[model samples]
Target: MRNDPLLSIKGLRVEFPTQDGPLVAVNNVDLDVARGEVLGIVGESGSGKTVLGLSAMGLIDRPGRLTAGQVVFDGQDVTKYSESGWRNIRGNRIAMIFQDPTTSLNPVQQIGAQMIEALQSHRDISRDNARQIIRNAMVRVGINSPDERLNAYPHQFSGGMRQRVVIAIALLNEPDLIIADEPTTALDVTIQAQILRDMRRLSRDTRTSLVWVTHDLGVVAQIAQRVAVMYAGRIVENGPTEKILKSPCHPYTEGLIASMPANALPGERLHSIPGGLPQLSKLPAGCSFAPRCNYAASACNMSPKLIQISSDHAVRCVSPLDGGS
Candidate 1:
């Protein structure tokens, strides 16, 4: 059906073997992303957002493994895909744009060479045809003189420009889904805005599903249609962007929203959630966030299941703010 989600992750549990024991990075996480939709996963560092994205792309490497879950893409289960199987689906059906283009791209290779290799790896197109596609993609991403730029090495470009090239490579394959893990975080405010705008336009034009992972709420406001707040290896809250931003239910979500720079008045002291993220390996017996929660009640001593507050809004908290249902 046309209504089916483009990607679905159910009961995803990714773990790593540590001396302490199995360190769970993502625990029973569930998410759905429809075609042409922009879903943002926001959380502090080590909250498992990056791990979850890698798992979705079948890129989880040694020491880290998906213990249980189903990753269905376009009606096919890719959770159990072999290495070769992933090779076909990775760049062809789903692509990834990492946080740092400087490291993701090779310094010795020319930009054109890398782009051509990426294209030819997944598609059977000739080098000449791939060159044309890469040129057009660079132009679409707002790079001037794409032909000349393509011939240059990654070091020749500026930080923002290199990121643009990375974006271009992700779009070159016209993949159905793109997982961008904080692609704009390394850039300045102006460059961040420009890159986000280009990506938004391109994804909409191509009807590609996007999963944007970041810790910046401002970035999510600019690009995401829906937002998921992750904490200590689990999603504590998720809902439409507008509702989640304006009426956060969970204490963690409330803290995140309150801490945004835009919410503060002139010269007013900024609000911040007390305490740091708890260690995942030694998480509390109840909710992981209960230690820092301002409104923790007696019921919070026990973990609460994700409860639906509305048709599309859910929060994993025993005592949600504003008397949420």
Candidate 2:
């Protein structure tokens, strides 16, 4: 990872107004993505990983608001940008590949036309030039017969192929940062692996920073250089991927790793975390994971600040398993 981060998020908090109360989807969070680096944000559904990614892109729609924090990209705080300002940065300097290609692509539009529109929206390019750029992007994402595929509608392609098209569109601008929210979850394992490999190669070759948000740690292990584990809207652990996987410090992190199929003994049932995630609006005080944690104690009743356990590893737990004091 580069020393100078290309994207930085500090004290980010996203919330939705509710009749009962404000539902905090993303608690105070800090994150960074360096140029040419792939950072994975991993957690179960409703863990705020997706909300966090959307907040970074300035896409948290009304009803949902960025209550606090700064999303700084390339030295500019984007949280303060106007709609027009966001237009200049979003899709040009930063792009996002959302899950479900069916939703991302226009069913009525030809693949080539959609890609061309995306390219032209950000760059003043002619039809022929835009087509060429789109074609190249398609090829980069492992789409075959770029010319032929361009003329095809989204529904004409399979699930994996449609996702490839979405990825191609996101890469057409060659943005500095790409936030992918579980883009491959809909594909079969084989196709998912292929796309992951292609994405990693593309990021490395283009020097684009990538933030991959997903529930699958397996996906993260394959593509990310670093990992941030989220739970109940806050990051519980952050560190190098190898270290996080091999020696998770937070209880939630440990539970996630222990529950992975690879960690199970042959013929043994996969482990699972004991409790479902708490409601955002009704989250308990202190460590949110404490209620489900085996090591919970009196100190866990008070919120624990994220403390550095190692030079590069941090965990938000009063009694981090890594032995930090």
Candidate 3:
């Protein structure tokens, strides 16, 4: 059913062993991506948005490890999947589209070769069939002359076109889940808008679930059906997109909304949240955000569990803001 979650992450914690100690990149995070749902994971840099996405895909390696929790994909406990086991899922059942295509694509290979390789890796398909699939995906992502573009190298395309090529590859398999980590960051405003439109259209037509990780609330407003607000390595708030945008309860979320260019008054100084993010290895004792939170009270001297505020909204604050503007 459309209401069913395609992926569920419970009590997730990701840690990296540092010289000082284990740096907790993600702390007790619980999240879900419903079938064909476009869920936005939004926060400032180093708030663990990317780490949580990678961990959900079982891509966290070595010093960075999943210290706790489970990542369930399509009812399977993917957290327990071995490297070899992950191969059957990664790029096949689940695909990730990175920000920069230049870094993700091979400079030396033709686009068609790369796309064909990706298809053949998971599916028992001939090169001719794979080429047709690749061409179709490229067209779906709005790439002009998809057949000719397949012969061109990554360098032959512009920044926007390169990203489209990456999207093409991701969609070639028609994966169940697509983890797009800031996929629009490298494009200009005009190009960014166009790409986002194309992605939304394709997501709807294909019924592919998307976990779009970004710091841009504007983008979230346009693409996401639900939003998760991460702060200091944990989800401080999450709910339907309109609710999160209009009536953010978490102070950090309120600050982020206040800092938006659209939210600022003309000729007035822009709003900003005071203080820097705490270093995970040496986070203060108590709530991680208590140091910077203006409304923090005595009860905030300890971590607060996520509390249900409504059927579709939840917040993690002992003193949440009351539908702040």
Candidate with maximal TM-score: 3
lDDT of 2 by residue, 1-325 (tens): 4477899999999999998799999999999888898999999988999999999899999989988999989988989999999999888889999999999989998988888888888889999999888888989999878998889999899999999989888898889999999999989999999999999899889888999999999999999999999999999999999988888889899889888888999889888888888998999999999989988999999999999988989999998995322
Cα lDDT, model 2, residue 166: 91
For all predicted structures, in order, the TM-scores are: 0.97, 0.97, 0.98
| Model 3 residue 101 distance off true place after TM-score fit, in angstroms | 1.0
When sorted by TM-score, best at the front, the candidate numbers are 3, 1, 2
**Total backbone collisions for each predicted model:** 0, 0, 0
| Total clashes for model 3 | 0
Clashing pairs in 3: none
Candidate RMSDs in Å, in order, are 1.4, 1.7, 1.1
**Per-residue alpha-carbon lDDT of model 1 for 1-325, expressed as tens digits?**
3899999999999999999888999999989999999999999999999999999999999989999989999999998889999999887789999999999999999999999999999879998899899989999999988888877999999999999999888888899999999999999999999999998997788889999999999899899999999999999998998888888898898888788778999789889999998888888988889889888877888988888888999999987777333
What lDDT, from 0 to 1, does candidate 3 have? 0.91
Per-residue lDDT tens digits for candidate 3, residues 188-245, read 9999999899989878988899999999999999999999999879999999999999
* Clash pairs detected, candidate 1: none
Point out the higher-scoring one by TM-score: 1 or 3. 3
